[model samples]
Each structure stands twice: as C-alpha cells, then as structure tokens.
Target: MKKQSFHIDGAKVTVYLDGPAWDGKPSATLGAFSCKTMQSGTSVLAQAISFVRDQGLNQIIGPMDGDTWHSYRFVTQTDGSPSFLLEPGNTPDALEVFKKAGFTEISGYFSARVPVVKTALTTPTATTDFTIEAWNGTHPEALFDQVFNLSTQAFARNAFFKPITRDDFMAMYMPMVPMLKPELIFFARQPDQTLAGFLFGTPNYAEGPKPTSAILKTYASLSKGAGQHLAHAFHKAAAAEGYETAIHALIHDDNLSAIRSASEGADIFRRYGLFGLKLNG
Candidate 1:
C-alpha cells in the first residue's frame, strides 16, 4: 500500500491507493478502484481530480480501475451473485461524498445477472440477413476493424464527454483482444464487405470474487437474435467449462433501445453511482 494525500492539507480526509499483486501498470489501476466505502480515499479522489484538472482533463469518468473499460464495475455487487461477477468496490455513502465534494452523476450504468434460459426474443434479431463467419489470423485484421467501427457507431453516444481516441482503446482493451474468442466473436458483413453489426463477448479473467462474467455485447445494424445466438454459445462454453455466472455491465438507463433489450436481462445487483464535479477555476 503506497499511501499519499493531496489538496486537503490538514483535513481529516485522506485517500489510500492500493495495488493488488496482480496488476502491472499506471496510477489509474493503482488507485481509484474500490467497491467498499471504507476503502475509498477522500484525499486520493481529491488529488487525482486535481491532477486531471491541472493536466487539462476536463472530464473524468470512472469507478474504473484504470482506463480500460472492461476492467471493473462501479456498482456494489450483491452477495447472491457469484463473486466473479463483482466489480470495482462501491459504497452507497460514496455517492453523497462525491455530491458533497462536487461530483454529479453524469450517467447511471446498470449491471444484473440473468439465468441462461432460452433465447426467447420474439422479434427477429436485426442481423438475420447477413452471413456470419469466424475470425482467424489468416483473415484480415481489417475485418475486425470493421466490427470495431460498427461497435463504435452503436455505442457512439453512451456517456462519452469527449471523443475517446483510438490510442486509448489500443492502450486499454486491445491488449486483451488476442485472448478473445475467435469463433464466438461474430461479424455480419454484406457481400460488399459492409459491416452491419457485431456480437462481441469473451471469457472474463480479472481480479475479483467471481470465476467468470457473462457481460456480452450486440453492436450493429443487424439482428439482435444473431447476437443472442452467439452469446448463448459463450454462456454454454462458460458453464461447460465449470464457470458459474455472468454480469451485464454498463447498461445506460437513458438509452431506451438498450432498456428494452435489457427488460429480460438480469436482476440488477446495484446501480453504479457516478458523480461529476466541475471545479471553480
């Protein structure tokens, strides 16, 4: 535990940044990631935010262990869900602390666990017309680029305060892309090579209480059913391999399309409390 306090010189507030033995990276991973209230450090949050402002970082979004979007969750987990489904430590009171400290909830993302029942979506998924295929080294990485671009389009407006750069994605999530499932990751492309939508999912391997997480994605102009089928493949693989459960993380409440899809999603463990504070310059 490398402890540091900033901004509040003589105040009773302090923030402690802890590094789990598993991580190997920057200060973002070192601090600002905890699910418990007692574990959150006031001084640490204050200092980190100050640093962001000083560095001209106008907007800071988190409960992120680091910048990697897939790394952890901001919500408080329920004991009933498998431990692997847990996210970054969350405390209910932290909401008030951030509020008092001048942070406001810019958005609320939802996470919930659902039983792997039937793919009972009655509406024909949007991806039915296109032919799907597997991705391997032999195939062009550009195909995956198409998938990613389509995903970017689908997720274009979700709580993004500023344009997130590609370099950030490469630094954060792309490092783990090699480990993603080739067969389960689907692509819906037309004969002209236009990407319709993409269903993306992977095996979860992060520091947490759960053995696996099943938060999958369906991003595109295609059928929801196509993604659902692919997701089932992932779930089946996870359970057959002796994994326990999955978590649907970061569902935007304001997005009505997502809400409808998530109506039958999972019983939410908790709503992630996000507060944004603008400093008086």
Candidate 2:
C-alpha cells in the first residue's frame, strides 16, 4: 500500500501504488487530488498516470481517498439541490477536468429523495421468516460489530470491494452514535436470533437543526426479502416520527437498492461518478 504524491503548479495528486484491481488488472488509485485550474489538473493527472504505468499497473481509479470507505467520486450532475450530510462533493469543474484528462466514468451512483408517506405506503408488508427490530441503543459496540460483519458479507461481490479491519470500521462509525436515532436503525433477525440484515438511517442534519428528511445511509441483507422488510420498517418509523421526506443516499446505479428507491417513487436529485484511466505499457 505504498503511496506517492505528485504536484504541478499548485495542483496535487497522490497515487496509491497498491490499490484494488480494476477488471482483474493491476491498478493504482489517484487520491487526495486537487487543482485550481484545468491545465494544472491535467498535468498532475498525466504525472500520476506515468507514475502508475512505471509501477506496472494497467488501471487507475479516483478521486477516491485510497478506498470507498472514505470520500470518493465527483458530483457529475445535480438538480440545484444543496449537498446532504456526509455527501461527497468536489469543485464544480472537477468532473470536466477528469474528462479532459482522458478519464471516464468507471462507476455511477446517485442520491434520490422521496416522500416518507409514499415510501411507507408502497412498500409491501413484511411477510418473511425474519423479524425486524429497532436498535435499543444498548451495547452500541455490539450493534456496530453486527453491522460490520453483515456489511462485509453483503458487499463482498461489489466492484472495487476491499476488506477493512473491524477497528477501522468502528472508528469510522462510533462518533455518529450520538446522532443516531434508535428507531431509524434496524436489524433483521431469524427465529433463532441469527442476524440477517441491518439498516442505518439518520436525520439530515445538513438540512438544519430540525430536519424533516431522514437519510437511509446504508443497508444490507443476507436473506430474501429482508432488505425490503428493513426498508419498510424504516419508512414507517420515519413517517410516524413526522419526517416528511426520505433520502436514499449513495446507491450504486445497478444495485437492487437503486431499483427499490425508484419503486418507492424516489426522484433522482444528484448523480456521481468514479473516474478511471487505463495505463499503457
């Protein structure tokens, strides 16, 4: 996981020499990227490319901060809406800069907004073998451990996936414990108490002190219908708590979560893309 940094007239980029592979090819990641102008950005990117090629890598992805667990992707499109809590954002010209540097979209994602009432009404009743329960805010560490385990399993097959240590995962989420609403976070368990799924939702604090929108940040399921059941429970609870809107945040374009968001009448409000460049030997 060696990293090298490059600079060009104030523009800077860091290359992670041991980044996750892209399409089974050796790859590097261009992260910690910044540039004040297109020319500087392009120059810096070219330097990064050269550095990656010298390492015998065939692909490069960015502007990820080493991995997907942190800030990544550029806001390629938007509907004039303000950014949300924990949303990844970049300079307005960042996407164009990447395009001019011979990078193309390697992955696509979007965030959508829907009325809580509509989502709650459209979601089918939970009739699965698993039962959904709200977190009681007790034993917070144990709860996150369950979430970390389920997330690793559920996202194992996702593109550019990488394994993270449990300590790192906890460090990333522990601070948010104070902001979490027990009702909005749920877990699906089998009759024998085996965990099947989990949903982590939070209020849109980026909106204001008392936000009306709830964010469905992340959710995963290992059992059939458990995902939908967890989502349904979240929406119902949000509506009961007087939340008017729900934001389905950062769903991959081809993921089932994206389809579920659309089926619930969510309107696409913002789009993002992870850019990639192919290195020539």
Candidate 3:
C-alpha cells in the first residue's frame, strides 16, 4: 500500500494507492483511494490522479479502500432517508469531485428496507439432506471460521473478490458478538452437521436509542433456497420480537440477493457506487 498527497492554494488531497491483485492475480491497477479533499476541489483530485499515473499505474479503481474488505464506495443517491449502521456516508461534493476528475461508476450497490410485519412467516423447507438451526452465541472463533470457509467458496465469484484470512474475518466481526441477537443469526446444515448456509442480522443501534429496526448484515449459501429460508426465519423472528422494520444492507446491483430482497417486499432506499478512472499512464 502507498500513500500520496498534494497541496495547492491551501487545498490538500490525500490518496492511497493500496490496490492488491484481484482474485489473486497481479495487475497494473492501483486503487485511487482514501481520497480526502479539504473541500470540493477538482484540482486536488486531478493532481492525485496524475501522481498515480506518473508512477506508471494504468487504471485506478476506487473510492475503494484498497479492496471490498474495507470501506469503499460513495453514497450516490438516497430516497432521502436516514442512514443505517455501517452505511457509507459521503457528501454531494465528493461525488462531484470524482466526476470532475473523470471517474465513472464501475459498480453499484444498494440498501433496502421493509416492514418486518410484511415479511411472510412461511419457512423454506430444507432439501432432504439439510437442516436449519439458529446461531447461538458460542465459540465465536469456531463459528466465524466456518463462516470464513463458506464465504471463500460462496463469494468466490463476487466482484473484486480476494481471499481474506479467517483471522481478518474474525477481527472484522467478533466485536459485534455482544450485540448479536441469537434469533437473528442462523445456519443451514447438511446431514453431516456442516454448515451450508448462514444469515447474520443485528438490531439497528445506529439510531441512538434502543432500536426497533434490524439490519440483515451478511449471508451466504451453498445451496438453492437456503438464503431465502434464512431470511424468512430471521424476518419472522425479528417481527415476533417487535422489530418494526428490517433493512437489507449493501447488496451489489448484480447479486441475486436483490431479487430476494424485493420478493420479500423490501424497498430500495439507498444507493452507493464505486468508481474507476482510467489514467493516461
């Protein structure tokens, strides 16, 4: 990872060239990221881009923080709604800075919300060899290890995917264990008692007071219908616990999960984008 900066006329811009290979292959791309401008200054962004190109980087992809494992994307649009926990927050000027600097949207992501009561209580039937269970808070390291293993395979085809270590995965999520409500986390298991799918949810503490809203954070499945089943179970459980709404968070525009969220009656309330700029290297 490399950090670059420039200043002109009291305006300063900081950019991090922290791109790693995508899906584990070497590339000429250097992510133009951690971009902070003292104000909405296109000259600053332009200079930062020029610095990366001068270093012989061919393409710059970001608003990405090195990769998807860390924070990325600019909040491109919203239905004028309140932000949720962990959602990307960016100013309108940030969008303008990227656009003025010749960046184009390379990927799109969105978050949706639905009334918990609107989600049907019908549970998805597991195939003959699989069963479903709740994730009780126990041996978190072991649990995350299982999740990390499955995530590697399940999310292998996702955009910008790279293999992250189990330790990194745990470090990213373990601190949230105390806030995890058991009913909101689930696992789909094969007859051998191995996990085939998982769903993770948390109460929306971003609201400051005790939150009645919930966020469906992350899920992955190796089999068909497992994801839907997990969603059904969690939405039902959340509603039963008096959660007024459920937010399906940060789904890629091309992901099948978008269809599932809509089928469950969720409304797209927020959109985020990651942009790419082709430098004249």
lDDT by residue (86-137, candidate 1, tens digit) is 2555455554445555666655666666654422223344443665655554
lDDT of 3 by residue, 1-281 (tens): 46766666645555666564543433223233333553536666677777777766657776765567777788888988888888778767777777877788978999999999888455566467667788777898788888889998998878776567777888888897787888889998988898889999988989876897999999999988888888888898899888999999999998888988888778999999888776553
Residue 55 CA displacement from its true place in model 3, Å: 3.0
Off by over 4 Å in 2: none
Q: Compare candidates 1 and 3 on TM-score and give the better one.
A: 3
What residue runs in model 1 are displaced by over 4 Å at the alpha carbon? 1-40, 47-73, 76-86, 90-96, 120-129, 134-144, 164-168, 205-213, 217-246
lDDT of 2 by residue, 1-281 (tens): 58999988869989988777789866788888888988888888888888788778888898887778777899889998988999998887667778887889999999999999988886666565889999998999999998899889998888988788899999999998999999999999998898999999999999999999999999988998898999999999999999999999999999998998998889999999999988655
Worst 10 residues of 3 by lDDT: 26-35
Query: Which residue ranges in model 3 land beyond 4 Å of their true spot?
Result: 1-40
Which is the leading candidate under lDDT? 2
| Models sorted by TM-score, best on top | 2, 3, 1
Error of 1 at 57 (Å): 8.4
Compared with the true structure, all predictions reach lDDT values of 0.49, 0.89, 0.77
